[model samples]
Target: MRTQVVIVGAGPSGLLLGQLLHKAGVDAVILERQSPDYVLGRIRAGVLEQVTLDVLAQAGVDQRMNKEGLVHTGFDLLFKGERHRIDLSGLTGGQKVMVYGQTEVTRDLMDARQAAGLTTIYEADDVQIHDFDSDHPSVSYSKNGKTQTISCDFIAGCDGFHGVCRASVPRKSIQEFEKVYPFGWLGVLSDTPPVHEELIYANSPRGFALCSQRSLTRSRYYLQVPLTDKVEQWSDDAFWGELRNRLDPEARENLVTGTSIEKSIAPLRSFVTEPMRFGTLFLAGDAAHIVPPTGAKGLNLAATDVKYLSDALIEACVEKSHAGIDHYSTRCLARIWRAERFSWWFTSLMHRFPDQGEIGQKFQEAELDYLIHSEAGSRTVAENYVGLPLNFGE
Candidate 1:
């Protein structure tokens, strides 16, 4: 009936925030609109920044990740039948990304929450938040044909873009910035050895493609498709055929084709909402911002959002200090905006926009050319890809 915090949506961000609060002796409950199985079934990007892995450890869920997640020190960028390696750790001073799937992170957090005897309300329908503008806020939902209300000191709106939390806010106070890419990524997950030791981003006359992996034995590959394209149009053979066409001969030769375990088309987009907080309700992850996956920032951005939010909540509840909570939005937006810029820039550089025309195509090529030849440009890309350090408050 009551808790210090009621988190909407039991996805990684919500569950992660709950884990941090629980560890700090804070009372929090997670409410989900779907079952755990449904949550884990969704496939997402898995480029883990150094900070994200550290956050998982703080939540007591990184033991498996540290052991099993693939560490990528660098990745290759291909254009005009040539591959240029960007040394991430060398450019970022020993920082690297881990190739642990987002599903794995969520599972770890879920397991920790269950082991800790934390309350998680799954399959709760029509979840709603109230009084977030006031000191005492509450979340209510229907379950088993009965209504339940949770009184809480604060609310976390981790329920994603279509989620009710952000949509529930009054539109008059919120400002939005968005760009829907003219293309989408048609990706396939397979149980074959990865085409390469590290991820590859390629730009060819055919289009843009990415070769990524979930682990040593599981590969994830993507090819840019028109917004009008359908997954049904792409069988495993067709997808693999299109993907190989976009890679250099060396990469193409090493590519392994197989039955697709999962396939989907995800539209690329960049979006941000001003002031991630509305009174006592704090928005985190897709609930507040979204980034194109070219920069591999979706989950890492969410990790920082929740990190700032959890730190604020812990400071407010444990230390009886409101400074962090009061400055939550200001702190989060600074970093969120930087990430949005990086994703947009990287997407513009790597993807072929239908509207960009021939001149635009040449410019994209020129930019990649410079990145490959110039140490400064390569370092810039490396720093962003590996993630910027977390710095907040003056």
Candidate 2:
């Protein structure tokens, strides 16, 4: 197989990159290790920053999102038994986040790609990249026990953190920066209606708990716990009890409990790789970096990466200049670092570290109190939450 570009993952980054390139009249092939059903069924981040929504709108993928997505003007910070709302829209001049699952976004992108007759190979195996230093880069893979090689002018490594594309690059040329949190999130999806209208980040003596909803009948919640904690050990009653104690202390009545639909654990970590491009291969999304889920920037950052990468590819292919491709790394890094810092800051602010002594806990509590009570602090949170201003210039 031959194409202008070979995308090495069917996740949001690779799929969106392929779609953007196709919209610009660039032919690209996408290969995925997972089946189409699995890719579409994966559950992940849900919050969409205003900048991300803009990109989706431009790509003509916002029609369903605008209709089905839930919009939030602010979120509540529950501390000291009081609720403080950060006015995201008011502080950011009408900017707000939309609650849309990553799965839905992937489904929409896949539908659009298929409707456009884009080539996507699912259940692909043994994918390998070769000759990234040359003008022509190729990907070798197996499907249905049959091996095949795809030759392309360039390769976009959107295969994610554990992907082979990143490993294909020389180790000496890579610099890794990472921080693993001491805790992980115990997430649950239930068929219960949300207790509150807006998302809530509640701090309690037990730990940090987040209250969010997926739809009218489906609600999602998370509890911060030790990374080694086992989900099987947590009974349904215990989970509901923890949520009620952490999130609803004020209610005189018992908080309602619903049947648990999905329960899983997610580790908290901050990771980033410097210079997202190497030779003819450019990395986007989780393939390049990962953020702690506190800031809800994972999917948003991937979308941002593809936006720049697709534009660079277009310039390189159309103008016959290497400038765009040459600067792809530097360009993507600026935005990536911004999100990295934001995610780190948010994670530190919300999570309780066991290593932090009494003084650290006091400081965290004081900071949370200030963020809820102080106008300036609330504004700072609002600006970051709504969306950072868009900067296309690398």
Candidate 3:
């Protein structure tokens, strides 16, 4: 097979990139190690920054999202038994987030890609990239007991953190920075209506909890837990019981409990690699960076990364301009670091670190008190939550 670009991983990042490139008259092939059903089965974050929505629109895959996704202009910050609304729209001049599940977004992209007749090989085994350091790069994978190779002008590594693309790089050629939190989030998904009209980030004596949603009737909630905890340790009744204990009285009273459709524990971490470009190979999304879900920047960051990457590839392929591709790393890293900082800051503010002790708790309370009461502090949180502009500092 031959193409202008070979995208590794059929996840949102790769799918979105392929869609964008195809719309721009560039030919690309996508390879995924898992089936489409397996990809959609992975429950992930649902918050959509405006930038992500725009990119989905650019990819021509926002019909379902615009129709079914819930739009929220604000969310509550519960602290010291008080619920304070951070007016995201009011603070950010009408910018808002869409509560659309990541799975839905991937589905839309997949549907669009299928309708457009793009090439995507799923369940591709032992995918490998060859000669990415030179001008001509190619990808190879095994399928149906036969190996096939795709010769391409460039390779896109959107496979993810544990993916082969990143693993293929020599350790000395790349620098990795990571911080693993001591606690994890125990999340539950149910068909119950949300307790509040908007999402709530609550900090209590017990721990931190988040009341989020996928739609008006489908709610997703989370609670801070020790890393040693397991899903089997908590039942539906216990989960609801513990969640109620963390919320303010009003929220607790309004909360609706039901059997969880899905439950899991996910650890928080901030990870980033420098210079996303490696010779003829470009890395985007989780392959290059990962942020804690606190700031809701994971998918949004990936969208922006794809936007930058697709534009760069289009410029190089169609316009015969190498500028965008050349500067892709510097441009993306700037925004990536900013998001990493925000995610780290937000996680630190909301989570109760086991090592922080009483002093840390006092400091968090003090900051939360100031943040909600002060307009400037409130806007800071609101703007970051809504996502910064793509050309943030530039």
Candidate 4:
């Protein structure tokens, strides 16, 4: 097979990038290690930044998301028995986030890809990228016990952190920076009505909790837990019992509990790699960086990476200019680091670190107090939460 670019991973980043390229008259192929059903079944973050919504629109896959996704203008922060609303749209000049599940976004993208008749190889095993740093690059994989290869001008590593694309890189050529938080989020999905109209992020003496929704009828909630806790350690009753103790009165009174449809614990971490490109190969999304989910920047960061990478590829393929492609890593990293800082700061402020003593607890309270009372501090939270302009300081 021959293509302009070969994308590893059929997740949103890879599919979004392929959609953008196909619309621009560029030929690309997507390879995924999982089945299509498996890919669509994974439940992930729902909060979509304004910039991410724009990218979905640009890819011609925003119709369903816009029609069905919930629009959140602001979110509430509960601290010290008080509820404070951070007006996101008011602070960001009419900007807001879309509360749509990540699974739904991927489904929409998959529909658009099929409608466009784009090429995607699912359940591809033993996938490998060959000679991405050389003049000619190619990808090889096994489908139904048969091996096939794709010859391409460039390779995109949208396969995520553990995916082959990043692992294929020479260890000596990559520099990694990482910070692993000591706590994890124990999340539950239920069919009950949400506790509030918009998301609620609560900080209490017990720990941190978040109440969000996939829709008016479907709710998603999270509570910070120790790293050592397992799913079996907490039953549905225990989960609700613990969540209620951490919420303020206003939020706690309205909360409804039900049997959980899904339950999982996710560890918090911030990870990034220097120079997202190696010769003809480029990394986007989790393949390149990761952020704590407190700020809802994980998928948005991927969207920005795809935006920069897709534009650069189009310029290189159509205009025959290598400038954008050459600078892809630098441009994407500039934005990635900003997101990292915000997510790190927000996570630090909201979560209770095991090492944080009484002094640290006081600092957390003071920061939240200032953020609630000061317009500038509130606006900073609002701006980052709704997301910064996609091309800022570029």
Worst 10 residues of 2 by lDDT: 248-257
The residue-by-residue lDDT of candidate 1 on 191-300, one tens digit each, is: 99999999999988778999999999999999999999999999899998889889999998999899999999999889999878899999999999999999789999
| TM-scores for every predicted model | 0.98, 0.96, 0.99, 0.99
Model 2 backbone overlap count: 0
Clashes of each: 0, 0, 0, 0
- Candidate 4 residue-wise lDDT at 112: 92
Q: Please, what is the whole-model Cα lDDT of each candidate in the order they appear?
A: 0.92, 0.85, 0.94, 0.93
* Higher-TM-score candidate of 1 and 3: 3
Off by over 4 Å in 2: 250-255, 392-394
Which 10-residue window of candidate 3 scores lowest in summed lDDT?
164-173
TM-score of 1: 0.98
Q: How does residue 118 of candidate 1 score in lDDT?
A: 90
Which candidate order results from sorting by lDDT in descending order? 3, 4, 1, 2
What is the descending TM-score order? 3, 4, 1, 2
Off by over 4 Å in 1: 392-394
Tens-place lDDT digits, model 4, residues 153-226: 99999999899988988999999999999999999999999999999898877899999999999999999999
In model 3, what lDDT does residue 267 have?
89
After the best TM-score superposition of candidate 2, give how far the Cα of residue 162 lies from its true spot, in angstroms. Answer: 0.6
Off by over 4 Å in 4: none
lDDT of 2 by residue, 1-394 (tens): 8899999999988888988898888999999999999997777888999888988877778889999899999998876666778888887788899998888889899999999998999989889999998877799999888999999988999999999988888889898899998999999888887767778887766788888877766778899989889999788888988887776565214245677888999998889887788889899999889998887889988888888888899888877788878887887788778878878987787777888776776787899987877878888888877667657343
